[model samples]
Target chain A: MTMHPDVAVLARYADGDPGLDEASVWSVESHLETCADCRARLAGQIPDDTRALLDVVGAAVGRGIEAGPAPARRRMAIRRRRLAVTPAPWLTMTAGVLGCAVLLHAIAPDLPSLVLLLAPVAPLPGVAASWNRRTDPAWELVAGTPSAGLGMLLRRTTAVLAVVIPLLALAGARTGAPLAMLLTPCLAFTAASIALGSLIGVRRAAAGLGTVWSVAVVAPSLATAQLPVVLTPGGAAAWAAAAVGMAGFAAARADLFRRLNSAD
Target chain B: MRTISAAETAPATYAWAVHAEQLKVRAGRHLAVDGLDLRLRTGVHGLLGPNGAGKTTLMRALATVLKTAGGELTLLGEPVSGRGDLRRVRRELGYLPQDFGFYPRFTVREFVEYMAWLKEMPKASIPAAAQRAVERVGLTAKADAKMKTLSGGMVRRAGIAQAIVNDPQVLLLDEPTVGLDPEQRLDFRELLADIGVDSCVLVSTHLVEDVVAACTDVVLVNEGKLVFQGSPEALMAHGEQGDPGFSPAERGYSALLRRHRGGAA
Candidate 1:
């Protein structure tokens, strides 16, 4: 309170003139932050037209905030909303697909890693649909939202994987594949798809990675009736490292989804 | 090129809800909105254009759905070129795309409330705001009905409800009245007039009557360029001469496009 800005300086700030130096403006703003009197004086200097517009907007927003249902009820409603839109149908179908893999392993006990092959790929389709704007009916609305970036996509992907992963674990238990073989490679592929999906769309990334896995590992393993090096215990550590690395890569490119084209 | 710092309480000269300068937008490889300049204040501004004239693309750019190919665009005083700025602008903006989509399983109320949340509305304020918006669109009775059960017109109304649920500072609706009946269209017009009192509302449509009835101003675009921007009277003035359309407004619209195309040729 020892010193105050000049009236002329306050007036210049009020009018939005470009003549005021940035340093002086910053000093005045910093001073005003601690000075209620200056703040009031500055508010008084706002143009009548702008003040009126602000008043109208303020009233509308005030009414909006004051209104609405009770918070507890709203929280419950939001929970129900999340439950309703959680892509349960697709997850259920994925479980059915996993069930088929389990049945295939039981029928051909000697078949080369039937469940192991299916386990890694089972979550791909569901994970792909979980975040792909094209597959979701509400994609237009969801994609345009402020939360439409990688955070939202990761949330949906996790939800899809949550359902599919456990099913894969159960399938591996039936097929006699090592737990490390089923879980690590499955997570690795999911993370890799998302990492690549950050550049291309998730659907294309899933399809491409799925095709590569089928050709590189699944096809070779079946032909030779021997476990691939990458699917063995030693490869588990590599898969674990890849999952962390790919997830980190996906997080770094989060902004890519924000500006993604609608068709993507 | 005036700059208003975040800390300054200065009143800007433009005071526009949306401002674009030589903005270029693309749909795939083709330029949709090419070198377009537009400024809108607080009012219902109707956007009139033919198919592929870039109205949707312009709307999408404004809504932050599509990236600008070139030039500058601002919404609610925030430049949309930056990710942070676009996120802040989107919080205060509402948009209903032409092909508005929704989850079939979500009830009407849940859908609107979810949109409010996505727009970052306060959790407590969401239910009432959503209820009011639903009631405004005459969907109070069906608030709890799943989205898939609603007919086409009802679905469109639901779309409108979500757009206005947050009482956004800038509301953009693309072909909002497409499936609405005559009576419903009238109701929608009245809603536009009511909301236009404070917020900047832009409606993009092929229908001229809606523009004449609700919009304070009309912008006509063709071939990704603005043909005219003025009052409906000025537009109708152009059609005063021997014209072939049914209504004066329609004739005016047709005449303006023909004149622009002729000039381009």
Candidate 2:
């Protein structure tokens, strides 16, 4: 049997006195947790002010426990919130642009395959989304992390492709654009942006590519109402080779992504 | 491997967790941090300077967000110029920007954990580490609250929480007390002392008193140049009755800045 705390010690403990020492206080508290009689005796020894404070705190805690969410439910809530994070908004925006392109092509089949013209740059937004310091609020924090290098960029870029490719394929199917032409150009532009992005930054690279593509391909195609030679099977093959070349170039210069102040 | 932790690698004055010599960093075309030499060890260091003095730029350079345009920069005994060394150094570094952004929808716990993951902490240890960090910042109750729901001070605390989530060896915080109330700033001082036991903490702020109260040493910079480096008491020593400030530290700060400006002029 353990010895109970003496009357004097119980009184000192109830007063919240530090003179009792941490060891003595710890022992008394541990004993009181298991010994109801000690608690009962200590309850009488507790100062009235302290007792009132305890009642208020205990009541508040009890009420809080009753009203608060269950641990399981809270976990589920966090899981749901995590889904809407990172690249989803960018992915959705890209999807919207593709949708517009598909609708435009359907309304005006003579207007030179908008889907085909725009497919190459479809993944650019999402690919560049996570890397931009200006647009991304968490850029500084993310940049400080160890894994925030070329590997992370590639993973995010791949995720963008996973969502975009399917959407591009759907748009192509609707607009009657060939799969090779639609998908190949998409790969070429994404690779080129990332390659050039290694030097200028991903967001800038994407924007530059998008602008040039619109000027050289989309705008001209719209003006003349004719799909350029770049939209052909031979052109698609050329884009594929360019995709491989640009990807290789990006890989060779992976060292650039590891540096700071590249305006990332 | 045993000898790698030896104290001899660094110069006699403390182990330099962050060391910069003649370092130049660019902010666009401007050289914000120019030819500055500084050494930091395992203690809370207060970085003090006037506006545009390059305190934030220096902090950014230390955080490795900006490349050193020239000179030498070493973190935890390794030169920061190497490619492979960056990842290892980054894992040991923590930074809170002057004005940070958060994913509004993420809960405080989620954000910290995400940062831990980004720092590449082991999967199993992330949750516990993140929780400990949140608790340290006194945000246990608000751990589940979304970032957008937090007040400004709470957001600042959340930023500090994420910065310390990995228990970084080199923690850089710029203007951390900008939004904090007096009481919260007091808590932050205690947290800084606790963390500074083994880590090198560099806190940049306009609040001179906060520096004098919490920091082991004061570093005053002007125009990308290091003007002063010494103990807080030494900083107070520079102040005279005529110097402008409410407290000794503030007067000392004014005196140092005045002297530096006078010299430059």
Candidate 3:
């Protein structure tokens, strides 16, 4: 008695028969046309081992096709989502600092009258430190991905500045200083401090390093002159631009370092 | 060369479902899993070790949650250390960390659904899949209950439920039956047996009975090295030489005596 073509084909595949060629394929196809049980059996005989291997290859191909634009899109989504949900620690810290500065302005209407003017800059360090600690883990995880680290850093820094710079402006107005003059130095210093703080924290430094550094820069200037000559409009603007540029560079490098480490 | 028959042609596939070579991990200065090589095939494989024996560390490396310091590891034929390999392999992998934490406010269903999402199951299919997993683990009644409201045993069952929610090809359960009572443990063993049909299930615990009842193979890792790998019967046979009074028995009183003597020996 002759076996069904489907059974023969499946037997050939299962029994390590090496002669399966166009004839065997045709025989199996014809057998499947009429035989449901044999077809089902043939389906089961496809070797799950081979199927699993194919699945892995298929999955890899699918991922390769999808991986390119995905990180960029995910990065943007994460940035937007983080911006929406991130607890504005900087805002709270800035508010606390502004409150302290306003209280001091009220208590000591100083000799230069602009002594209360530099109080906003004093809180820059604290705000920078808080932001660094709050955002570092998230930034590190993002950096591990193929996302643009600078893009994410800029988004976070912009979000922080959005909240902090305006509060400093309000403080400047209250201190009887020009909004532009107060804003320039405060923004410049805050931006620079954030860049430095983020870089230091990524290197696993102890917390408050940024605050100490920022204080070192500002404290000496404050003790020497009520409003230093560098606090002038053109000088402050130049410092702010330079600070922003440096922050951009630091954020990019920090991201690159994290990615390289993760890859290794 | 003589050609072998297909049935006799030793399976070209069915290689180690998990293979790790020279796996190294460090926590501060302490080496967690050090230069360990491991291979697991089908059936329930029990990982036996005392606490801090690097069992959990090894499990985490296999689960792809923790990266190894030095190793070439493969899961289901894919290099585990590769960027997207975890996500891909994780689709067919189920892991229950020893100390599982869930969002306290989430319902059991919600938690499992979240896991399904993380496992990359289709969103549309997650609800039914979660329901099936809950039912399989006998948690259908507690499906809507808040995770925090569940008892410790129920929480453990829920964790197992989530791990197997995707019907993974590789199921890694870390102390899966820790908080369960006898009846629940039996029920869990039945569930594991049912799921082990087309998948490789591994449960890590020091409990010998758990291995004896559920696992076809037992692996004992002592101080980050594989000390033994074989069937429970083989392990019992090894121990029998040292203890002449020990004898294997069927269930109930006789089995209890054998276990006691084995322990005392």
- Give one digit per residue, the lDDT tens place, for model 3 in B45-144: 9887656778987886777655567878888878865444245566778888787766566688877876676566776677788889999899999998
lDDT tens digits, residues A1-264, model 3? 234764566867654467988777666667677878886786677767877886999999999888766543311222244354443564676578677766676776663334234533544433443334244332221222223234444555577667766776677777776666666665655555545544454223223433554476456654764555566556766866766796676655553322223211
In candidate 1, the residue pairs with backbone N, CA or C atoms under 3 Å apart (3 or more residues apart, or in different chains) clash, namely A68-B128
The DockQ leader among the candidates is: 2
In model 2, the number of clashes is: 0
Off by over 4 Å in 1: A1-86, A260-263, B1-14, B82-85
The 10-residue segment with the lowest total lDDT in model 1 chain A = A72-81
Off by over 4 Å in 2: A1-90, B1-14, B82-84
TM-score computed on alpha carbons, candidate 1: 0.81
Q: Which residue pairs collide in model 2, if any? A: none
Candidate 1, residues B1-265: lDDT per residue as tens digits? 1233463354544578899989999988999999998999989999999888999999988888888899998887778855563566777788899997788878999889988988887776787888899999999999999999999999999999999987777999999999899999999999999999878999999989889988999999998888899988888888965777789999999999988989999
Q: Evaluate residue B237 in candidate 2 and report its C-alpha lDDT on the 0 to 100 scale.
A: 97
What lDDT score goes with residue A89 in model 1?
72
